[model samples]
Target: MSGNSSRRSPVERFFRMSLYVFAGLVLLQLSLALLAEIWPWLLGIGIIAGGISITVWWLRHRNTW
Candidate 1:
């Protein structure tokens, strides 16, 4: 056999990228959640903005992937 590999489909690639983004966001949110205890207003705004951006991204890409 050969060692060559096939390229991933666009949808598969997009899904994998999304997974990575989701994981990073989860970590970021976790840290923000912890910091929120110290600065509730600032961290709360950051969290809300992050949530909105994530939701918009999902809505736009959901049909493509």
Candidate 2:
């Protein structure tokens, strides 16, 4: 309402981008999990990748990396 240009600040842009990436990763996990359900070996790999993604996200936010 203040007639501002509504530009995103650097932190806001980073947050938005990270959120989108996190959502995309989750979607990918779902797809891979489904495939893994059909072929069991992929289950372990998919889970490991998911864990790594979460760990990386935690590290990023913790250290602003």
Cα displacement (Å) at residue 61, model 2: 64
Residue 11 of model 1 has an lDDT of: 95
Candidate 1 has a TM-score of 0.45
Global lDDT of each candidate: 0.90, 0.89
**For residues 1-65, could you state the per-residue lDDT of candidate 2 as single tens digits?**
66566777899999999999999999999998887777766677789999999999999899975
Q: Which residue pairs of candidate 2 clash?
A: none
Off by over 4 Å in 2: 1-4, 39-65
For model 1, the superposed segments whose C-alpha errors exceed 4 Å read 1-6, 38-65
Task: Give TM-scores for every candidate, taking all chains together and pairing residue i with residue i.
Answer: 0.45, 0.50
| CA RMSD of all predictions | 17.7, 17.4
* Candidate 1: residue pairs that collide: none
Clashes of each: 0, 0
Candidate 1: how many backbone clashes? Answer: 0
Error of 2 at 24 (Å): 0.7
